[model samples]
Target: MVSFNKFLASVFLAVAYASSSIAAPRPAHSKFATHRARVVGRGLQVEAFHPPSTFQTFGEGIDHPLSKRTESTMEDSAVAFVGSQLKVDFNTIAVRSGFSGEAAKHVFLRQSHDSIPFANAVANVAFNHDDKVVAFGSSFVTPNSIASSSPAIPLEAAIATAEAALGGKFNQHPATLEYFVKQDGSVALTHVMQIQDGEAGIWFEAFVDAHSGELLSVTDFVAKASYQVLPIQKEMLTQGFEVLTDPQDMTASPAGWHNTGTTSATSTSTTAGNNAIAFKGTQSSVTTQSSNGLNFIFTQDPTQAPTVAANVDAARVNAFYLVNSIHDLTYKYGFTEAAFNFQQNNFGKGGAQNDRVTISVQSSAGIDNADFSTPPDGQSGAMRMFLWDFTSPMRDGALENDIVVHENTHGVTNRMTGGGTGRCLQTTEAGGMGEGWSDAMADWTEHNSSAVPDFVLGAYVENKASGIRTHPYSTNATVNPLRYSSIATLNEVHNIGEVWANMLHNVYAALVAAHGWSATARTDPTGPEGNIVFLHLFIDALALQPCNPTFVNARDAWIQADVNRYGGANKCILWNAFASRGLGVNAANFVDSSAVPAGC
Candidate 1:
């Protein structure tokens, strides 16, 4: 009943004051330093945007502060637009977004760059302002361009210039985000944006289910407020250096699965039941068990993945490692701390009723290679066959783990949500969220398979034909290979798998910083905390997200996710985590959402 903006305003006040700078971030076992807020990638290149003597809002730069309360300015247009474009609760959501969090976004940019209009965004109040919802938004800020007074240009010029202003390309692959209300009674959009300062941070922009506002990808930039913008980026003030400075108490640029776990298998004994066995091929002397269920046939694949034979108690032990790790971080959001019981058969065969948690392990050399195609712009591996019902015998191991975990995610997610396939897929041939969720579950599983370093994937190595890899996250659907990037457009769990990963991936980074996770293989047994953190969030996202398949649904799911996980009881904890770092989540903030969600 309280307005969302009021909630936002209230939330921001707490966020603004809370010191987000946590202990310096260092891998739990790093000799480089225990906790350092700054991280240098392989080649620490100089940036292009230089810091101003005083980073203040637009009006501040020119002797004015962002109009003290400019909420109404956006409200006039923002509200009318939402009313015209949306039918759901925008009447109040608009009022809340337009106000509670409106001034704060301008403040964030103003504090960093001269107050100017931020372009292309989507936001959620991090806190509630005076009962209104307060949130954050992101955008590419640019200084005013010099006058080109030859002749007056058309509005398209504004569109072109506006596009440039936000640091976006007109020819972007999926193009700008387009919001729509689907016939299925869903409101969502595709794509969004992240204000890049240059190479300091350039995660990737894979895709955005742009049509329905499902973010396929966007920037996973995290920075702290205390640390000022980079020092060298001078001429690039007008053009951000593509870097996201000052990630508050977290890894701004995290690297996952760059290599296999130093976990060597060549020396392990050919034990049938021990997970310690090096799984290089289907013929490994692993488990040789058969299914005992009337509906399921389990076996450690002697020929391929479906390696149900070797992974009996070992897989469950590994699962316990994962579930226990999650209990340490954010799953506190779960109303029911999900069941982690293990079984070889019918993991979700009976639908939502009989299934809540399922675990299956893939012990094949081929599948372990994480055959997820090369990333950046990949096309193959798992996300392709999302449509399959997954019932073959060999489908029992690695593939089984993937399918079971995913379907199980749905069953658990149904607790809070009424239950239905999340957003459909861009490709009709494959299952939508089911596939995405499955793949994501695998990613999560592999991330936590062991408490070892390199929370990477595909350590099992199912096939030798394809080179080794940790596994690519999502597929483009249009293409055969898979692609990895920020959350932008989302069609299904698989289509939007990247989005969920991006969110949880960073959450893991935060947990690493928060709990001071061990870094190196010696001190940090679990690699990055993100692997475990992501799993914790998965159980939570599924349970709390709207039972529908819409980006807005997911967007709302995220809000609830944050509240249930961090805010409320730990309001100070989660909010300071985002805002103190300059990350904004507000309407008209995602960049792509401008035309779609339209800042409402």
Candidate 2:
């Protein structure tokens, strides 16, 4: 397994080499000189590249550079285009971030001042594999609202104030001056500070009012916390055993445990050359191991629960396997080597280092939860699967395939959208949709697993009937009863997320209804050919949405993706699914997570 430090060094070297090969900005033709514009809110702007031959529709068929490139090169291209063609003052803007996914076909760039993203120029630009500037969605604004030239408080004083606001000692990353957008659409030049407490899995960003040194806002990046009982004649329910009869507590042989690993397809190229990686465990003890041969095992089970070791090990194995499998499957559709993937061992492909995902099995107990913090591509992010034995019906979350997959999906969704660097999906509505994606993906995984699998999640531990939710997801309104209106009253993201999940469920069911279910749905996520159409459109939608997207914007992106991919072939199916949940063509738009569309 490659170390994180080694991965960074390799990237830096590759970037250094690629820097010299940067091509001069291509001249924008007369037809492509003017960009197509879309109006956002009052005085806000949204624009995209709309040339004749270059700007193809949004799917994967368009040819991209298969040659190696770096995030820096991609950003340089975008900055150049915005500077020369758009004629924006490049000095006023700072390169907030630029990232590329291992399996993605493009590198994304976020433009803002300091480290605060989406502040001044809320630009999300993408460069295809060929190192040419391809697409963008920008709400660009010049730095016009700075109250003062210099900060009233110095950097050290601002750090101290933010630390006090945090209420605990935190190892702080370098703080930078950035612009912060207020609730009332005002922007303030502030000091943005990133704090990390690895022991607690806490990652947060603090925006300090530079003029007054007051902590303007603190965004907590710490996604909350997981266990095992593996897979069938399930005896050790915590280990996924299914005993024929409840012989009280009979111990059975742990042979052929499903938790060992599962197989998924992978690729190094954009073409048909694909391979499979069977994700399973290696010969490494949980405690001392930071990584396995094929995956990274960051934390191991403690000695306090000797019996829990086997369960934890198997759960970790399954978690790694599920993430790898999903990456491979998603890759086949459009997620190429350019999109980020979690892995310790790379196939020696170009620019494949430092993309390993950190996995913690049966993390420090007390919370029955799982989370995935998706940092930038090269940077490492950890997923904690905590043991859910805090109260009654003890539940081992690690062994739950749905829970593990759901958490991993968080990483995928976060990285894929918002410039491929964990932006967007931060607002309440976007967050709810993020949660919706996790639940929908988990439900889809299980629904296709067993011949008659229950769509509920965390059934054994969270809830037997609903499983961590009010009810199992259903297309029939009475069984679920969740819709866009549900978001109006239930403001919580998980609750509001159910509405979005139901919409996705109906879409999935409708797709299956159109194209019959294929037994290999796991390997082929799109049930069949027509089913793959929705998946293709859905993934493309992630790329189209701007940072901090609302439900309506998200809904439109999917529709537009269909227009780009199939030229509106499946628009009716997509529209019917969203409209069933009150997100119709004529439905009123609501940016608030607590406010749902009025028309059902």
In terms of lDDT, the best-performing candidate is 2
Worst 10 residues of 1 by lDDT: 373-382
Question: What is the per-residue lDDT of model 1 for residues 108-130, given as tens digits with 9 covering 90 to 100?
Answer: 11111121111121222222222
For model 2 the local lDDT of residue 64 reads: 29
For all candidates, the clash counts are 140, 34
**lDDT tens readout by residue for model 2, 1-600:** 233344334433433443333245632211111222222112222222211111222433232232234444555555665565445666544455444532223434434543344432455555444454435455554444644546777777666655544443445545667666543334667777766655566565666667755455544454450112232112123443321221111111011111111233331111011111121222233322222222223232433342355445555544544554455556555544345544333344332335455666656633678787776555555677776764443456655777776787777778667555564566556677888888877776555322323367777555464578777788777888887656656555677677787788888777767665665543454443544665676677677666655566677777666655555666777777887778876654331232223332
Q: Over all chains combined, what TM-score does candidate 2 have?
A: 0.67
| Worst 10 contiguous positions by lDDT, candidate 2 | 247-256
User: Can you give the TM-score per candidate against the true fold?
Assistant: 0.31, 0.67
lDDT of 1: 0.26
lDDT of each model, Cα atoms only? 0.26, 0.52
